[model samples]
Target: MIKTKTLFTKLFLSYSMIIFLSFTLFGLVFIYIFHLNLYDDYEELYDFHYERLQEQIAQSAEEGWSDEETADLIQPSLHHRNYNIFIYDNTGELFIQPEGDAEYEPDQEIILTASDEFVSEGATMNGNLSYIIADSFSVPGNEETYVAVMVFHDLNHQYQQMALMVLIPFIITIAFSGGIIYFISQKITAPLRHMNEAALQLATGDFSRRVTVSSRDEIGQLGDTFNYMAEELNSLEKMRKEFIANVSHDLRSPLTSMKGFIVALLDGTIPENKRDHYYLLMKEETERVIQLVNDTLDMSRLEAGQIEIAPAPYNLTRQLQRIAVLLEPQLERKGVGIQLEPEDTDLFVVADKDRIEQALVNLLHNALQFSLNGETIRIQLETTGDMLAVHVQDEGKGIPEAQLKHIWERFYKGEKSRTGKGGTGIGLSIVKSIMELHKTEITVKSKLGQGTVFTFQLPLKK
Candidate 1:
């Protein structure tokens, strides 16, 4: 169904046109530059021979030499190059002629024109046809002026045969060149044609569409790049569908709870003595909905490159301590404790402090979500070369290896926590975005029964 097939057609037609124009240009060059006009060269050669012979005959003429005797003197030498001459008088009587189809005469105008000074017609003759050139010449002052005419025979036809011999091969070459052009154009445009079809499928929301790459040339590279784009687009499309479904489910929870609380209160099911408790719970649900919306907006802004990181020097160790203190209540409720490595120490780092704080809180909260009772979540700091590494380790039901790659995706509730965990499912995604803003990445190491560790790096303050 791909209708945009013009690239091949355009390439084919353009290459053919270029080849055709090249052929025409080469033909002109061959004719003009390479001495292919044999007809004119032959005619000029005959004229030169006639001039030399006539000069000899005029200089060698004797008293009372008949016109016929002059003709015999100027007769064709052996191995004639297909040319002859004639002599005549002013009355237009032919005194001498050549062996040919003999129905010719000298015109009276040519006879009169040559009476005083020598005159000759220089017009080119037709193919193999003979013509007359009348001129009367006498050596200086002798009263014996005779009309002489030279005839060129078969030179034009001979030139035509030579040209035909060359042109037949040239025509064959042009035809062969057309075939070569057709194949080359197809080979060049083949990938583009496939890409066009794939692109059309992409337009119809078929992100799985891909092109075949057969070579390492530019066209093949383009095909490989297109397939990569399609794969990423397909992943994004899946994420889009998942995000919509999760948002609907998350919104329905808070909304349904609020609706239930309202129905109970309006019908006096929640008694006046217990109304305050129900009101507090409804407010909490409303706050949860607001937090969900804000988190989605935060992810959106981060992904759209709208949130610029404002980095500065900060005490990273102090920041981690403060985050642990702020989460003291949640840690207490979960029966988990936070322990800082090499306690009572401080280290400085350069980063966006507020964003880093957000990341730490999210990681700690995630640990609190899955940590068993009486488990100690450890926060460690180490320096290696130019950067400082921070690790958050927890004694929790660790993520599956297959699920680890997806933990940072929005709404990715892995198999372990998907059933029991009460999370908005974007906490790790926000943490990942924050680390990316610092020009680094967060990595996780975990096993099925063991705990998980989340590690990232920050630029140490110099």
Candidate 2:
């Protein structure tokens, strides 16, 4: 619901309101000024007509025209202009009608009559123009017989036009103002839209997307800041993954040797027949401790980028055979058979011989741990184009689906499958790291209660 009020809508509304109000105010002012000008024209026309009529009447007196003759000239002027002219005697009685009705009572007439103090009354008559202002002036020579002149100015039609002019522009300006506001808001908020999209992508874990930096404005600066944050997060994530991998591998080696030696010693391999048996047991424990220390140091060096891999062409088949020999005792104790699958014995891969052998040894030992007696742990080698894949497969209870992904994670164990099983949970992690260093790939395939296979592939020398 909140998202509905988008930037566009807000911008449009805000700007539209401002424009609408400004236009409305301007329109009202224009209409006021226009109406005032229109009224001024009417006032000047009325005054001119009144003064001209007085001149004509004075001229008629000089030319010996009667009041009736002067009234004839004024009568025509008032005919089409919606006005009435009249003359009143000293007693304010009707003397002549310029255009039409002259029998109006003094109270019913809108007379602009003047004696010493000019007086005028406004009246609304049904057959007339509904409003009247009369001007009166005394006939110069016949002061006793003063002349009263009445004029009517129709205000209704003028007022109606003024109102229409005011209302029309007001409506049009409001609409135009609203449209302008919308356009301006969209222009101003364009950068924010880009920033919003970038933020959404970042929330979804896409740190690769960067906000668009289009201007030197504040919104552009915000975009730059967001992009910088994404860069930092990407770097941090990389470091975190490296740390987990290093910690996992560093813990696997010694734990494997320790469990192996402890099992052997407990199985009476070191005799209870001699005190030297205790010394041998102590030596085995010391070796386990030493192996653990070395693995930790190696992992630290690798993560620190201080270690270099010296890749060379090495016989991968021979390497697997050596690991099988190394773990032969452990395999026998676990009652598992070790078998080397038939392949090109001279098959070679490009890698650091020592590192590859160590990796192969870890893989073999890991497979042997889960295998029972008479179950074959097969070591197979395959070549695809320029890659050499060595697979360590165990016929022991297969890895659970839920544990496959977590198997390479440090200190992670399948909740149900890990109980009572002795493992440092770091062997596969080391296998992963070593393969990464070699630019190799490792994969696993297993079904519950069926069997498990771990495959590590290294690039082969062409």
Candidate 3:
């Protein structure tokens, strides 16, 4: 199998071929037009000379000069660089021969009785292609006594000279054009080549590689997009490594605690009275482990599109009130009051009720964990146009501005100390995924040391 050519090579070859063919065609046309023009000028020259010779013959005949005088009179006018002149009498005899040694004998019968005023024909003489022109003139003294002049013009030398003159410039033009075209093609494809190299590096797990943009054209835009993708992949690679480390740490901590508690109870390290307490501690650690595993599985399923949303009409306000009542014990323990500020009208929305409830639980739990004692957690529902917006506001230490953007990413915890606050760091990610499944977006507005508000909109049932 033959290997294919590179893009640069193909472009250069195609451009060069086009230039070469164009120059070849133009040269052919130029040569053809030059040939025609040369012939026209040659015929005109012969006609002019023939007319001058006739005037000279009329003058000689009017003055009654002899044949020798007439020949001398017309000789100067008959001389030409590219043509040989012969004059024939009415009796088909040569009257004036050319001044130099002739290569072939002139045809007297053809020259004298030629019918046309200007007759041009091709003849082979002395192994070369030659052009012959014949014209007749009547002497002023006698109308019947006429003289016919034949001009033999050799064309092989002129054609050879013209070919040489046209071919040299044509070759030079093709060479110059090919060089310029190659340079331009290289400039055009340079970005694509860099992008190809960067893509290869990325495929090999080197996400740091990037392409340099040199133009504002489509190829440059492609290079920019490639660089952006590489940056994203690099960020994702870092996140993946961090995720693995976080998972390992979270898993190991719970397993190690449970292992220690079990060993202490089994080996009599703890007093008999404390065994029950240690067992309870082990059970709590095991529960934490189970929660982590469940959250991880939920996130995986959501991201893999394995979870389907079943939407239906449900009362938005009643759902929030119910979640608050259910979490009344936890909220009471923390001294955090639940405030439900819903619209007075029965606000119904079309969404997956179970998924929305899960999202609300996550957000409410997050608020409860962060709220200070005696602070109020507000669950507000407001109607805006055809959408019903829900807001979960916590009067707790707010998230920093820098960490706000990454709050919805899996395993991204803004407060490291909140790891023990009953969260697997997958709650917000789950909520975000659920909201996205409903074709809506979750938004957060927070400032450090103030409070955080989590808002999402749902379509109101018409």
Write down the TM-score of every candidate. 0.74, 0.48, 0.80
> Which portions of model 2 miss their true places by more than 4 Å?
1-4, 60-65, 82-132, 144-156, 159-180, 247-462
Q: Who wins the TM-score comparison? A: 3
Error in Å for residue 115 of model 1: 16
Candidate 2 per-residue lDDT, tens place, 211-256, comes to 7687787877887888899997776566456546644554565456
Candidate 3 regions exceeding 4 Å error are: 1-4, 65-69, 89-95, 104-113, 121-124, 136-141, 145-154, 177-191, 212-220, 252-308, 325-337, 343-346, 372-374, 409-426
Which regions of candidate 1 are displaced past 4 Å?
A: 1-5, 33-67, 78-82, 85-122, 125-191, 208-217, 271-280, 384-387, 400-425, 460-462
Query: Which predicted model would earn the best lDDT?
Result: 3
The per-model lDDT (C-alpha) reads 0.75, 0.68, 0.81
C-alpha RMSD between model 1 and the true structure: 5.7
Collision count for each candidate, in order: 0, 4, 0
What's the CA RMSD for each of the models? 5.7, 14.6, 4.3
**Model 1: per-residue lDDT, tens digit, 1-462?**
533456767776777678777767776676664343444554466557557655756655644467566666665541245655666555667655665635344456666776665554434444335444445655544555556665555545654765776588778977898788779878988888889999999999999788989999999889989999999888777777767777777789989999999999999898899999899889878977887898889888988989989999999988888888978877887789999996677788999999999888888878877788999999999999889999999888788788888898876667346337445577799999888888898999997677899999998899
> Which 10 consecutive positions of candidate 2 have the poorest summed lDDT?
104-113
| TM-score ranking from best candidate downward | 3, 1, 2
TM-score, candidate 3, is: 0.80
